[model samples]
Each structure stands twice: as C-alpha cells, then as structure tokens.
Target: MTKRSEVHWRVSEFESGQPFIVMEQYAGDELDLFKKFIGFDLPDGTSLDEAKQIRDLLSRKLIRVSET
Candidate 1:
C-alpha cells in the first residue's frame, strides 16, 4: 500500500525480468555524475522538470563551492 512497497515490487519485477537493463541504468547514473566535471550534459531523457529539480537541490547547498 505504501509507495516504498510499490517501488520494492517494481524493482523485484525488474530484477526478475531484465536485470541487465537495471544494471545499465545504475551504471549510466554513475557515468552521468562523473561526466559533470567535464561539462557533459544530462542524458537526452532528462526533462526540464528534472533539471529544475537538480538545480534547486544544488542551489540549496550551503557549502558555497564554485564548482556549481
């Protein structure tokens, strides 16, 4: 009934049906973060909303680093 439960079920289904695709997704996210240092853009499937979410999260950081 909870969202966590739903996500667990979906992950289980994914693991059972096509583990390779899920592995690829995890790898891709890691690669994306690494590529950020070189100014590589987010993947094509990333939406404006997601970009806004990432920007909002990054802007909230209080560390005051110039990397962003």
Candidate 2:
C-alpha cells in the first residue's frame, strides 16, 4: 500500500461469509482501521492479523488512484 492508502473490503462469502460492503479503511493508523473493521460485525473470532490481512489484500485488489 502507498501513502494515504485504504483498504476498502467488501464483505464476501469467501472472505467473511457475509454479503455487505466493508467500509474504506484509510491507510496509516492500521490499529484504528482494524478497530473499525471489527465494529463492522465481521464473523466472530476474526483476529487483528486477519483484519490487517483483509486490508492488505484489498489495498492490492483495488485500482490504484493516482495522487494528484
């Protein structure tokens, strides 16, 4: 991920067995991002590392927006 990046993870059955969109996880302050993800009501037992991984994966999957 780059500066000012975010992990916009949509809830998928494959990822979290849900059918909803996870909020955009702004880059920096990863701890805060994870806290937000947890609040989204992810499947029970989702760990901090799992949340981080989800964000990392999303940061890669999404298209890179050029910083103006």
Best by lDDT: 2
State which candidate has the highest TM-score. 2
- What value of lDDT does candidate 2 attain over all alpha carbons? 0.51
Candidate 2 Cα outliers beyond 4 Å, as residue runs: 1-22, 25-40, 64-68
Q: Residue 16 in model 1: shift from native, Å?
A: 36
Residue 31 in model 1: lDDT: 32
Error of 1 at 17 (Å): 33
Lowest lDDT block of 10, candidate 1 = 2-11
Model 1 regions lying over 4 Å from their true place: 1-40, 66-68
**Local error of candidate 1 at 6, Å?**
40
Tens-place lDDT per residue, model 1, 1-68, is: 11111000011112223211111121111333233322224444555566555545544542122211
lDDT of residue 46 for candidate 1: 59
Every candidate's CA RMSD: 16.7, 9.5
